[model samples]
Target: MQREPLVLESAAGPHTIINSKEVVNFASANYLGFIGHEQLLNSCTSALEKYGVGSCGPRGFYGTIDVHLDCEARIAKFLGTPDSILYSYGLSTMFSAIPCFSKKGDIIVVDEGVHWGIQNGLYLSRSTVVYFKHNDMESLQNTLEKITSENKRIKKVRRYIVAEAVYQNSGQIAPLDEIIKLKEKYRFRVLLDESNSFGVLGSSGRGLTEYCGVPVEKVDLITASMGHALATEGGFCTGSARFIDHQRLSSSGYVFSASLPPYLASAAITAIDVLEKNPDLISKLKENIAKLWTGLSDIQGLSIASTPESPIVYLRLETSTGSVKDDLKLLEDIADHALKEDSVFVVVSKRSTLDKCRLPIGIRLFVSAAHSESDLLKACESLKRAAKIVLVNHI
Candidate 1:
């Protein structure tokens, strides 16, 4: 059966107001405008017409299509790893991997502010859990040293370190280089969820490993969400042939869930090619990020969250809830002036909890290869205006 397309009425480079009867949305993960790219559209359309809508069974079953296999193989090469496996979603690949290799007495060392997927996985795993400070290498090393110092008692059990290349919320990147160094010293396995970094970093866009000049061959495990950077649906886990083999055999998410759609696989591969051909888009994205960072720093009103080197940049909105409920509306109001009134577009981050109002939190300014210098300046201008309107008038 074919899937229903959510027609947007229209879309251009990076700005799609989604003015359909459907909904105006900022909840999208299409960071680089990959979905509307003609290359991806044509390739995925061809695959859909050729392969149908969805896989009928799991990959281990009768669901392995030639296109799917090719996509998986090519992803490994693209990421500089020997092997890769696809999952229906990124969180599934990441969460399921943690528990697959660990068991009781084994310890899962995690960053305190890791994505909820890691936190939840540790809760479900039989392994004892240890959480160090977010992106604090010394904290990670201290935890490792404390555990391994009692080597004889801990000999039967093992430890694994898990973190993301870029945090989804605050956009702060993890210190993988130092973590890798600690792995060598402490004998801990590492899993890096490259969800927020892939297709948005490095010359080849292989993610943080490449950005940091680390060899993928040395990293034991890697996982990523395709939805964001790839402008497609699904996720993937990549590593050595042996590790992938074990994951395929052991990961429940891979075994039980329906495999990713063939069209998505085809589109993802083509999307990677587009990224490779246009290295400058990646560079431009960085420029936008840098501009946003610099602009925010110069502003005396707001506090930028942990400075981001990636596409997702956030700041701490200093207004109270009495000032605004669902900052999305304030952002939407700003977007109207920016997009509607002034013909500019920006995605304003939303706040779900009450404490989120002034709890050292703020907006996530997303930039893509599709945005222009004028667009970024416009967004910054709008953000500053909105912040003042809400903060000064205490709206």
Candidate 2:
């Protein structure tokens, strides 16, 4: 049987109306609660009035506006990088950026747990792709050694190590410090995706490189999205001036797609400005994460799969309820029960088997800075209750 998707007629926040029912929202990516922020709203409104809605053509064909350049420069400054190139859509950033540098003859060693975007990019790159175990430094070392040893005679080939600073599949932070050490040891260029970490990690929200104390120069190419914590609708790649220049001309997404809407560029710029002025927002988010982690500490029939500092909290089955299909159904039922009985909206990770991911399925509960202590407690309590009811037979 097929089910109709619920319609949301309200803005996504800590609380929202779904199917005309008010629910505590745990399915959104508004990590810093900037989705409905007043300053961001005001900035977008002002830009809309001044620049109107959309850019009519591709960035290469008279679509590059001042706001687009401003936003890219602002992001570069915030991250302390030499330059950045913007894309209208978030996923396109990876799909385009990968092929921009890596091509048919080169090699890209990536984590197996990377999201669909990276997978698609790998396909498009036509490169010799190698997969390492998820965040396993030893596995990465072995893969690099094997590849390097096999290709030692191929002087013309290029090599790259690609990974996400914070993995979307498992909600785990990549040990970037170790990855960098391996990159240096193997002489492979590092291409990092900070999509989930940017504007959420680090003291100043400069992403995992900053949080891990890895110098920006160590990374050859870095890509991220402004749609999450930045509360904007575009993506960016920040690195050396040479890298940015190459992407401007060679990256298909940036060269062929219409530039980001000017209002969104304004919103992204304002988001960075706000982050600069109020460092406490990150601190507040940290506090909220700690509170939520502590509250969910004792839930039965479930285990927490994310770190306490991670804004994304994943609740996995303590044991398989049955087969894979049956387990997936149980997880989704828990989410549905949370929504129907307790008015708490949550999500279960559902992916096509074709994706080749090894991560476990779980109920994904996204925590935000906007969530109050009461909201955290409500969600935790509801999740616990729902898990108990749904898994009673399995237990």
Candidate 3:
């Protein structure tokens, strides 16, 4: 029997209404608890009254508003970058920004576990793409060395190393310090995607560079989706003035797509304000992450795959079922049982047909600052029970 998709009847937050019942939400990436913030709402309302929703044209063609420039400047200042360019949509940022710099003859060494947006960008760029083992610094070093030794035109061809701050599929944090060391040694420009890390990591919410104690200027480019932590509807790329200026004229998404709604741009600016004023929100989020991680430490037949610092708590099976479909079914059953029987909303890591992720399937729990200790406890107990019921039956 086919199952109906669960409909959210309320705003996505620590607790959400679904099927007429409120459930502890572990599926949303509202990491800083910014979704539906009062201040953000007010800002959006003000911008809406002034600008009325859409920008009505591409950024190049009268769609650029004061709020857009303000939002871009705000992001750049927050990240300590020289400049930034904003995109109408979060997912479009990766696909557009990547191909803008890399071209057919360039070489891009990428992590295999990056999201589909990056994969599509690499495909579109028509660059000679090489894959390194996900988050394996040694493998990346080896790949770079191999490329340098084999290609006589290595110095002539543009070289780039692309990786995510926090992998979406695995929830593992990349070793940015090590990656920086390697990029310098190999003479490759670094392009980091902080979609899941921005406003979530670091004491001040400056993302991976701050978390790793590396200077932000060391990385050539950084891209992030504001939807996760900002609770807004767009994305931005931050870098040197040269990179931002080049993208302004050539990036397909920025050049052709309609500008981000003025209200959303305002919301993003207000979100940054909220983040800066309340640094304690990041600390609170870390506390919740620790509580959830400790609670889920001893589940049977599964192991936590995410790092202790990551807001995303991923639980993968200790052993695969010898088939991807079977493993996914087990995970789905566990998630469904948790929702139906325990009233805790969780999600299975289901991959698209186009996704080439080789990582193990798992159940992902997105922890939030808004989650109370009781919420974490309830989710832990419910998932433990669900995993036992589902895994025991499957065996």
By lDDT, highest first, what's the ranking?
Answer: 3, 2, 1
Whose TM-score is higher: candidate 1's or candidate 2's? Answer: 2
Error of 2 at 146 (Å): 0.8
Candidate RMSDs in order: 4.8, 1.2, 1.0
Give the whole-model CA lDDT for all candidates, comma-separated: 0.74, 0.89, 0.93
Per-residue lDDT of candidate 1, residues 266-317 (tens digit): 9988988888788877777777778767776754346677546767776665
- Residue 124 miss distance in model 1 (angstroms): 2.3
Q: Estimate each model's TM-score.
A: 0.86, 0.97, 0.99
Worst 10 residues of 2 by lDDT: 1-10
Cα shift from native, residue 52, model 3 (Å): 0.3
Q: Write model 3 residue lDDT over 50-115, tens digit each, in one string.
A: 999898999999999999999999999998999999999999999999999999999999999898
Task: Residues 25-101, candidate 2: write the lDDT tens digits.
Answer: 98988888999899999999999999899989889999999999999999899888999999999988998999999
Best by lDDT: 3
**What 10-residue stretch in candidate 3 is worst by lDDT?**
1-10
Q: What is the lDDT of candidate 3?
A: 0.93
